[model samples]
Target chain A: MKPAPFQYLAPRSIEETVELLREHGEDAKVLAGGQSLVPMLNFRLARPAVLIDVNSVTGLDGIEVEDGTLSVGATTRQRTLERRLSAGGSGAQDGGWALLGEAAGHIGHLHIRTRGTVGGSLAHADPAAELPAAVSALGATLVARSRDGEREIAPHEFFQGFFTTALRPDELLTRVRVPSWPEGTRSCLLEVSRRRGDFAQVAVAAVVAMADGRVVRAGVALAGVGASTVEAPDVAAGLVGEVPRPQLIAELADDLCARLDPPSDTHGSAGYRRALAGHLLQRALLDATSPTGAAAAA
Target chain B: MDVQQESVVDPAAAGPAAGVQEVTIRVTVNGAVHERPVPVRTSLVDFLREDLGLTGSHVGCEHGVCGACTVLLDAEPVRGCLLFAVQADGHEVTTVEALATGDELHPLQQAFWEHHGLQCGFCTPGILLTAYDLLRERHGVSEAEIREALSGNLCRCTGYQGIVRSIQAADESWER
Candidate 1:
């Protein structure tokens, strides 16, 4: 169970950290909260010659709303984000950022949330991870930095494939910027995992806004059915300027079910994921459109 | 600009060579500061058990699946196995050993005993610390919340009925 030999370096500043990343390049792996990395290290699945510990890097743990975007620093722990979105936390209001709390609660166990970072989960890019789908549904932009400079990549472009990302070996994911919901916009997340806190078999995030009883905007994204969180543009387009009734949601969900072509795995079959995606999206939409504080049916 | 300028880079600066690297870390565990040089791969659980002789935090499923190696890092529950000793540098760690005071067992330990929360006691330490952190952090935690909080710690014995009862009893018996 012991991890292979590696050198650990703790850089005190972001510049020094970037320098370390540029120096080591692909040979070094950045360590955030270590919730996912250390487990892989112990299993000998990840063997980086040098580990650049970013936990000590300054100015990488802030959470704030800047210019209508909820900017989350790279090292912000998942538990911190969860609490901030909970009943009394900062995200309780203003753009429905509290929806992150719902998705964060479904991530692993409480201990894992305490140690897992938002950037770590997104960078890991697990198909079943709930955070990625939630962020994607929010249409968030990921910020990556290297020796050259910084570049902002959208979630759709950032996530390349299974456990693969557009992040270069010399780049460090520095932050994520999620555009806050407009006034009266509501959002919710739903996932059907095998166990209570396990990775989602099919996860969905729904953000919807209505003006004069007609849908003004909608964003729907699904996870666990593809390499990255699958955003339904057609569904979003069909939903605009229409009434979001039960029948309309059902039609959109049916279209989504037909569009997904998930692979079969030990956890579930391709058909099962396709069916699960439809149901999860339906439930998420219902929850988002329902009155606040009224519990959505399971 | 000053902060950026202050970041001096020395390309010739030494880093880990090949695979082996030794680093010194200072961790305050159970109210005592210990400084030691350990391999980069040494997990906090191993460092505590082997070097510091604090075996109260047990190691199970070293890949962080099982919560047997859970400990309070800076007052938050985290799996010690998932963290290298180097990560704990300049941090505070609370283990199961800190739960009792000399001859007197803490209220949580007493509640576990009175409620029969353990049979083999292998998972007790991790459960105890996990419950302790929950009780301290959150006030008036309900049964459902208790179950959710302790969900990470897996207790094969007692089927978690007694463990849940113990935590509830501890909550009621404590002043909080």
Candidate 2:
């Protein structure tokens, strides 16, 4: 497997990466973990003129919690974050910690996870992928910087379309900041894939807050169903101003299905995807709202 | 001007190939540092196997599906097949060869042998380093988590059951 010839530069710091990026301009691609970019190179799918290796950059692989927000550096590898989050070392706030940790545990395999960076995945912007959906569902902020300045993009606005992001040339994602887990809120992610490690045909992430045993706030995001994450505002509205019951989640599922027109992909038939979307959405919502947290959770 | 942070490229030396001009890169692999001039396009897998004489990190599929080329990049497991040698310059990279202190097998390696974690052993190095990275974190990973963690690696021999078991046992008992 041969790739197109390209110049390589190993930059030692983010400032260097930014400078080198300015030097190379649109011809260069930032080498994060290379889990995705390398494959694209081998397949001859990507042919960048220069590669700015950002691995040597210090302070870009850190995960820190500051002032009610969790900030994850763009270069932080997935396995490292999974390990840190699972170990509760990210100092996650209430509802966000457990679910983010749970979601991290479900990403690809050890080797892929070890080398794959969340920023890379976010930058690559695969619509059917998990991290993008998780970030969207959790409403994380995407931060990108270039030689000129930095820009902040919300999850809903970050994704431009399938395989496309709002990031401009010469800009690199620097970090993702997510809201602290709110009180009385529980969340869960349910994904259905034909095989392990394959892209999800349909995946759902749900967050529900209960006040005195009554549903107060809800957020729902689905991946692998559309060009970007399909946020079910109606489904979330269904839960809110109502109570947490099996019937309500089921109703939300039906309403969400009606709202989202899932596209047909190789993984599954369009009809099959729609059906699974409803089913998975219902199940994910129920799991999030579960009092025991073990009932029907896999 | 933001896109021209570095000193302006002289107009006399501008071309498509100029953007990708080859350069020398020095890499520290396993224990030794290698200083050599290679084309900018060569991957790290080729450099380790061909230049440095470290072949333990296997290259399976070459498309990043098989984990045969897994190695530790700055103590983190990564597919060697995917990175360019230029990227590893100045980093402490530990391949499968560096797992043992002397002749003593890394506990994860020992567990794989006793548990029959491998059948043909073609995918062992990839699996070994992957598990090595996973076990580094505390807080008890679950069985389902173990399966998800290794999903990037495809074992053609179908020895995943024992493979998972080996990683599970190693996570509980292995030490640095």
Which candidate wins on DockQ?
Answer: 1
Tens-digit lDDT track for model 1 on A1-298? Answer: 3877676778888888888888899898889988889888888899987788888788888788898788999999999999897545767685467667777888899999999998899999998888888888778899999889999999889988899999998899999998877777888888888876788899988788777877788787888999777888788788889887889889989987887888689999999999989887887887777666253574
Give the Å shift of residue A241 in candidate 1: 1.0
Weakest 10 consecutive residues of candidate 2 chain A by summed lDDT: A85-94
Per-candidate clashes come to 0, 6
Instruction: List the pairs of residues colliding in candidate 1.
Output: none
Q: TM-scores of all models?
A: 0.95, 0.86
After superposing candidate 1 on the true structure, give the runs of residues whose Cα lies further than 4 Å from its correct spot: A292-295, B1-19, B137-139
lDDT by residue (tens digit), candidate 2, B1-176:
12212222334556544533455677777778878866667778888888888888888888777778988888877778887776776687888888877989988899898888998888888878777777777547788777766776778785589998888888777865
- Listed models, DockQ each: 0.43, 0.40
lDDT of 2: 0.77
TM-score of decoy 1: 0.95
